[model samples]
Target chain A: MVASSTARTGAGGQTLVVDLAYPPDPGRAPFTRADLVVTGVDHSGTSYEVRLYLDNPGADIDTPRDPEAGYAGRYTVFGHGGCYGDEGHCEVPEAAGDPTDVRPVHQLTPLDTFVTVTDALRRVLDRDGRLSTVTMVPVSLTPRRSDRSPAPELLEFADLSLHTYLAATDLDVPTPG
Target chain B: MGVRRSAASLSVAELTDLRDAFTALYGISDDRGYAFLAGVHGLPLPQYCKHGSILFLPWHRAYLYFMERAMIDALRRSRDDPAAAVSLPWWDWSSAAAHADGGGLPPGWLAPADGGANALASGPMTLGDADLEQVRTNLPGAVTDGADPVTVRDPDTPDQLPKATTVNRALSATSFTEFSQIVEGIHNGVHGWVGGAMSAVPIAAYDPIFWSHHAMIDRLWYLWQLSPQGADPSAALLDTALPPWPMTVRQTLSVPNLGYDYAAQVVG
Candidate 1:
């Protein structure tokens, strides 16, 4: 992955880095998928998991316990962070035992995987001749409970990156002049 | 490019009036409420899927597009009705009046009402999770079952709640903070760079109006950025990425990808 710093603060402040990975060329058949990986080092060794989620029909990306089974529809895995006790379904079983799961941590997903999913979605949309936009969000993980209040400190490591792409067929149509 | 139109020319009272009038004309209730909404917006009938979910941002933009169209249509009908006194109004929640007390809840939008804790109830009243469930269980046919489809239930009457009451109650009470809070709360209240993966499903399954809510939230951020106490104006709160993801400020501002444009005045 190619990385560049876009936003920087003082020495003590955190810096926002932009990673530009190779795009999937429609001319080519399928290509190797790339993952957007963020690694965070705390007292413990680096710990992370790669996650991908569907952006449509917004719902919880992680499956819930029996009590929350009713709300399974609203799931999306856009960013990575510390593992929670109930995040059992989304958790990499080996990493769940770590107490640091509650602390700041990074979640990684190969970039190519995301593109592939998005590309498939685009093809479906293309077949239907529909114009739509999908937002691909990238977030960094830190050791923190998903339920805790949002703080600048916690936000220090998290960033929201958005990507916009058009299907090859979508490009051929004329946009309003 | 032509000069952008200003949303400032619109007023919240007018929007509320238009919404109410439309509700009255179409008979806003659970069974036909969504259809009325679709009709007013001039949308083709929705082709829904049992397992597919509404895509975020785009879906909402479509909703808002129809809403705007509905408002315009309402305005034209009112011109002929003469009896109708409604007009479109924009809710500028960012105004000082909205945040006078510092809490996020805007005044006058909803009033607290008492009901059994476990039942799903609806109307211009506040009900706990129980009432919410009741409303959910009885949603009209147009409403689809999804991962987090909003629900309502009333424990007291259990069987007697009107569909309209439940839907209106849900629409009025649901907000962005509530959705975000639920997600965070479910995850044990931790905050950090958990990434967009977590938000995807909720956002997708989220009502099409979710985009308008986010647009409103984005508008708040814009307004907050202008405040003296706001975070650094130069700070980039949104991550930048290349297509099929956009990375630059200019790219981020494009409406085609976002699905809708803020009334220029709202941005100001």
Candidate 2:
């Protein structure tokens, strides 16, 4: 990972903002590509969509999904609905359940989602040279119960990071060989 | 042994046999019934599934195997000889043809069956009072008052379906974990694109197309497993148990060992 940043959910779980910077040197950049890696994504609730915008501070659900608007890309989480099993069945054990237990981890365990935003990141970098904050707009598709005491949150993730990678160096060749 | 083919390539006879199997299974009305198998995915009691975990792919593979085997049993009960020949066909939603016509739903799944309801398009969502509450618990206002609440779909435009490039990139993944997440994201997008009951996980499996959709995902994993860049899952993951089904991750890795293999597309 070359250039990276991390962030949690924003106020009211409406949006998330994370700081992302461009590589220092473009001529001989260390990284060949970039990606937006979302880690520890909780899929135990209703499904929803998260639209990522590069640097548009005012980006919202109404924002146009295009490069001009800093709309990088979007991804959806197919939620597991909710736990209907017996008590503790859906709980992610802090440690292994039992020493001899062979059962897999809870189905609702947090997972990771990765999106290769190379083109989007490059477009922003080329224009501004150095890119900053990424704004995410979350929209829940599942209908919630109006009478429920507390509304269930649609967006839950541990961290949103920008990761860059290095490709194999180009082969050296003699001039006019 | 069974050979699963792309849903688009199934012959008229093959489609008929598959539909017949569904009808036969639907009629059983017992634990072996279609509804019972479908409910096992989500809703009612025992929502045996593994999503958002490393076991996501392998668990669903075992689930599909269980359902396919039950379909064979249903065909056998109806005295349909060579029942084993009929394996579940996958809806290739990420193919060139799928995205060509604005990304329409699979015609075989949507088309009406001979002289009546198409079991492929939709099937009876037999939910009891408790089960109905379970649906509303997650989905809120789904399954309103109705005598026959058959599964319904409100699919998005074909353009909304995942592009072939999206899936091709997932297939190119070097690690099983990376491959699963990419493919799973695509899977989630397709589920939401299908909307209606299909969009919600609790009642998703009740829709007949869910089986084929998962079959498509399972097929992708099978292809990835055989690819040069593909590597076997970690040792711990391979040995983990997918409950409600007796199989482990290792057992589900080999499609042929589970008695089925996806057929190579028959190009003209």
Candidate 3:
């Protein structure tokens, strides 16, 4: 409902460059705030990407153009998960050498799906940590593959749940005071 | 060597053999190809999943069995030993071995020499469009071109992986949904723990350890089936057919009937 109308890039609204490789290889851990994370709170506080999970197949995710570019969808409670935080900031790097890379516009559905998944996510700090994640992706004007490339339907999404799981940090997600 | 053992009990040599076999499959780009093998996952055709549904345990059980058979065949052909019985090992991240060293990634997957080629991180891969589009155009039996990849950034941090007790707790759920979801929670944790190519749902199978990770998941389900609370699904769920997959929920319930089993009792 209440969200900023601008997609959060980096410190001063700059899109951060990230290297993505599949058949996953070892890389940096979620050691700092700069590392991309997934959560219920959006880092930008605005320009929210409304993502939908696999359970919902008939959800609307079309984003209005012009001044309402990224804010067409509902508040993306299931926060950012990939590198560069929000979907708006991530792009497939220019030089995709041997293993190729491409920036597929990640898509998300409008909010309203309730009781998503309420399961236990064990935490080293807490014994009974339950992970009740809210899912979201960018408001896609069209459908495509997980790579963010243009596809037919806008209903699909990459199962980036773990990215959200590993990247959850207190920095991005503020505690209600 | 025939059964799927825990990553902790495995020797570096044994892990190396599995690693090499996995890589060998990756090299095949045709039917029953490496990419095809990996494509049978969640990306393009996210259908017929044995998760959030009745087939969650059985479907994966069948998938793992098929994979083991493929590995056995590969080993026989490549090594020219008809008796090269090498079943993929399982990595119970919640176990002690996960906390041993470089996260849950065994030395074979991390070591530059042994599993270096098959090491998901050791190789160079450009992450982008080509991969997402692979299943739709290249691979077979995908959904209506609607799928997503799994997300993982760092795959070798030990602390990042789940503990054995964490998984044991998942087995305590009373209902099928509770048990499956908790099990999946652990499954998702490992994928994220071994982030990188293994993070995405579709491309996870490409990683050598993905099968092992899923094996652990499947094994947990097996353990549940043997428990007191575990029972057959209700009629509606049992009859529900997983699309693009010929088998129904009832068809995938048994591991013994599917042939092969996991090694040792993965005590909760």
Candidate 4:
């Protein structure tokens, strides 16, 4: 995977974005798993700038758990966590744009999807200029719990931040060839 | 290269060997030694744990292989037989889930600690107390990351156990991603079911059942690999290196490459 580094500077703040292009693996569809676009990265050497979690789907290795449960407004309690809905209906990364623009990945691989820090996190960029933490929500999810029937967060996640394996490495930084 | 058998199917001797081997490994304190085996799944940096990604099956397969190798070696030592026939066993929770009283907990795990080394109880944990903690070895020197490392297992945490039928459904998936979603979903359900120390993600490996549970999950994947419908990653996904993992997804697909098969599946 060859990548190029680019930082987007805006009035709000600076987002270190990396574009990663993976070579064709074999008989897979062309570009089906092509470029990985990561935004809101810290890009500073050492420490993690970005973290990716798969919610209940991609929790971690060795430990497998109940997917339907959560705790608190969003605290992961017992088998389940905070949400009162199902992770199945949540369309993340895509819905990242706005509440209504969310689209589900369906049975497709998440390779084409873009992952970014959803909102401004005070701790996102450390004093050293590296990303501190990132929390992702399905595009339609509001930090405040929704009282509707189709709430994706109702069953999607309490916290997925711990699922990533690439922490403490430059893997999140897409270096340009 | 030994076959992994179901715990219920193991003869008295085989079970004893497994218990002894685990006890031996559990007693070791060195990070690079036996503790390292379990720590691979726990702290000292849970670097190779691949969750929420395509490498889920492969990474655990490799990690299981290493731990199983350690078990086999330890078992051989326990029996003092250079050629001792010992292998790690798996818990068929999917089948157990079907039983009226199966999914609660394996009786073997809760066996009364009548002056015997209890594997499930974490009695006198030799790996730096019960925490199974570690310092960062990836860097030049070990340092505290100040991460919370604890283990918990609550029997009632899981809402539903993965039935054999559910696993069969996963096997029925036509795509690798589809199969993983269902299979891994069931996998997550069980982890939550065995709450307590098991509920904690980073330190769950400290529980004895964690290994057996994963064996079942790996066996399911192996079963899928044997089927004609089994899907392998295409070139598009092949190059996606499972970071912190030494191997690729394509490399971990073949069970034979790792040198093991399910005991029950082999017909001679």
lDDT of 4 by residue, B1-268 (tens): 7788886677767677777777777666664345576556544343346554566777787778777777777767766888865566788776654344544555566646575545654422233522333222211111123343223344642224555555665676666775665465566556655654454334457667788888888998888878777878666867555434466677778887878878765332
* Runs with alpha carbons beyond 4 Å of true place in candidate 3: A1-177, B42-54, B113-153, B243-245, B265-268
User: Lowest summed lDDT over 10 consecutive residues: which window, candidate 2 chain A?
Assistant: A168-177
Q: Which ten residues in a row have the lowest lDDT in candidate 4 chain B?
A: B135-144
Candidate 1 TM-score, C-alpha based: 0.29
Per-residue lDDT of model 1, residues B1-268, tens digit only: 1121222343555445544544343433343343344322211212110111112222333344444444444545645664444322323333444334432222222223553321111112122344224323322211224443332111111121112222222222223322222222222111112211112221121222222333453443333333343332123422322222223333433444534334444432
lDDT values, one for every candidate = 0.27, 0.75, 0.45, 0.45
Error of 4 at B268 (Å): 15
**Using TM-score as the measure, what is the rank order of every candidate, best first?**
2, 4, 3, 1
Cα lDDT tens digits for candidate 4, A1-177: 333333222212221112211121241122211112332221111111122222122222112222121000111111211111245422233335576843322211222113212111112212222232222211111111121112222222211221122223221221110
* lDDT, model 4: 0.45
RMSD of each: 20.7, 5.7, 15.7, 16.5
Per-model B-chain TM-score: 0.35, 0.93, 0.78, 0.80
- Residue A108, candidate 4: how far off, in angstroms? 21
For model 3 the local lDDT of residue B229 reads: 73
Instruction: Highest TM-score: give the candidate number.
Output: 2
- Native-vs-model 3 lDDT? 0.45
Off by over 4 Å in 2: A2-13, A23-29, A83-93, A96-103, A143-152, A168-177, B80-84, B111-115, B140-144
